[model samples]
Target: MASNGLLRECVQQLKSSKHDYEKVLGGSVEVVWQSVSSAIERHLRLKKGVGVPGLGKFSFIRDFQPLTPVFLLNDRFISSYGVSWKRPPPSLVIPIAELNMSVLGSEAGLPKDQVAQTLDAVCAFVGGRLQKGSASGRIPVGNVGFFQCEGKNLQFVFDPSFVKSLVQSSNDAKPNVKPAADPIKPTVQPNSVANRTSIAMTDAIGSISQLSLSRLVNEEPDSSSDKSSDQKNDKRDHHRHHKHKHRHSKSTPHLPLSTQSDTQTSTSTQSQQILPRFLMLDPLRAPPRHLTSDSKYARVQDSAYERETEDVKNRVARSAHEVEEIARRTKAAQLRYLQTKAEKSVLEREMNAFLHGQMEFKRNAKQQEDARRSSAMEYDAVKILPRDPIVTAAQRREVKLKLRRRLNDQVALKDDLAKQKRAVDQAESAYFLSKLQLHAAHEQEERAERQRIEREALVAGWTQQLAVRAQHEQLHPTRKHR
Candidate 1:
């Protein structure tokens, strides 16, 4: 089930209880559920498991086969079989109603309502801590494990010691029962007595079959030779019967020797070809003694060993391929990085050149502006100076016209310089804005590139870990026996 469904159930339960949680939890049932769910999600993103005093521990377990996260009830929860202390398989569904809140509250010396309120308070506290920690970018690690957030998702890596402790606890909780013996040996032991026995049996069977076939092929039709062969076969049969009787007597001392011999004779008379003694014994009634040390058994062992060896080889080859792929990607990333760096350098140089040119243009404009101001001051002084008494009216009028024309030219030049200055100011502002935008874009690209690199590195690390685990399993395969 999804977490939302679980939260909905909690909300329904709270509403059915008809408690005024608004005062204690500061919300109605739906709001409280939302707050609790949000708190749980945030906490789980930062820790392995979140525990409630009167409720079960909530955890997310990554299934080995699927490698997908499964919601789990880690404590104070029972499986479908109603076994409370057993370590159940990871599951999505949980029986929330099975929790004995009253008993738990009594054990804690608090009322049920208070216990519920306490749970709410805990959720609030965790939410507050997470918000504070996220703002500071320094989330504290939990005892079992911690989470690393990547964008909107969280990646969890469990501690080895914590996993070991969980394993130990599960083992301790299991009932002590002796393991049953395997009917067939799953592993091969080349130097074992069972292997030697199987080898000898195979050789004997081959030799016996070859001798029987050769005798049938090379038979003579002469009456004297036939009689002689019959006599020899009779003697051989008697000797085999005696040997079988002796062995059975030694194996089954409870049975009388006479009865064993009579049964062996009856079996011998019924079959033309004598089967192996192991074939006569019922597999279900007796332990397989020689049956387990036969050619078929040896073949099974050999095939299992071959398969295991092949699997190991395949894993090693896969690991090598992954490493090569990672290396190739790393090289490609380095090339891209170098190219980006070169482009960035070129852009910086161009920007610097543009800014330098703008500064020079502004400096030349200023110098022209100063020269214009100085010429205006000189014209003002000329206008203010006293006139000569001997000068004629026509000369004075011509001089006045010349002065007015010069002043008009100076005013127009000053207006043009002001317009040029305003245009330069606008250009400078645009250039700075573009530069800021380019810088922001570059930073965003770099961040994206960094996140990609980190993701690749994490994948490579996981691949390496899998390879190491495969190698470790190959080296210590006997651990599985334990």
Candidate 2:
């Protein structure tokens, strides 16, 4: 297998790919890469797949699988680039400092400590994967290949079948392929951006025009004008009628006597009289025009009286219901209390009876036992004494030895208990000491953290002041000389 380029070269290539997202992200190549790499790491941690545009997807697998990022190439990209893998994977070991420098672009802009931390995290993840895979003797590296442990050494086993299948499937799934260009087609110079934009605008206008023409062909003739004309004609006739009425009125006599008395009376009656005969009855009359006027004052008063009576009735009903509920609840509580009292009395009576019976039984048994003992003592007194008694010194000696051994064992047990007490005391003291140490350590850590924060703030303020001083010097360089 050919030797692969260093990580530096890889980072350079990545930076070159910055054109892919430069306009969209509006960030430098280093920033974009950092964001992308962090996102990839985050996705891997969550066991989700991360996709790099125009490149491939990196996925994480669960279970006994190797903790490696799986790179699945895009079919179109693979075909365009004519990508192929070597049989043996090349070594990718690089110093943490170098990798951090490459990734961050500048040490002055980004802290080395932060870079080092990030590099450590990445290395830890990779090492974890290596360890997990080494356990199973096989670690899969997505579409590229896999690593297998052979004895003490690890070796890469390349397999291009999976990648090839992915490409084939993608090619099959893609639709609407344009016709292939001629093999010997003449090369055309690329147009300027402005010219291309203008051409696109012209095409868009032409398509819009064609669409409008098609709509015009399909649309029915508009009848809006005819309706508008009729409306105008009606308006004109209305205006003329209004003008004629105004002139006629001015020409007519104004005297009430000039009008017919019968017509005037008929209009007055019609305006004053109710429309429905039923409405003439007070109970069935239409609602009064003025609720508080003299004409409807009696009705309003009656309504108020009725409302008051209803309110009184509702109050009485509510009070009665509330009284009944309270009485019912009180009665129920009293009944429950009586029932419980009765049960308690019954239980107490039964308990007293049981106790009395038990005491009588015990007294009788005790008397019977005393009588049996007296009978046995009388029988023993009447029995004849043994002719001879055997004496054994060994039995007496054994009894004394057993008693002495028991005493010695008791003494040893007490001594052992005292030792245990001393051990417990020592353990308690040690525990107290440890607790004090832990508390002191915690306090020290907190103080250190606070001091570090204060230091960082002070440093930031100093840097800002320095920056301001530099700016002032730049703006007023000749002031000192003057």
Residues 357-446 of candidate 2: C-alpha lDDT, one tens digit per residue = 687699899999888877844665476868876769998899999999999999999999999999999999999999999999999999
RMSD of 2: 54.4
Residue-by-residue lDDT tens digits, candidate 1, 147-195 = 3332322233445565565556545655874685354323324575544
Candidate 1 residue spans exceeding 4 A from truth: 1-57, 60-100, 128-161, 167-255, 261-482
Go through the candidates in order and give each one's C-alpha lDDT.
0.50, 0.48
Per-structure clash totals for the candidates: 0, 0
Model 1's TM-score against the true structure: 0.22
Per-candidate TM equals 0.22, 0.19
lDDT of 2: 0.48
Among these predictions, the greatest TM-score belongs to 1
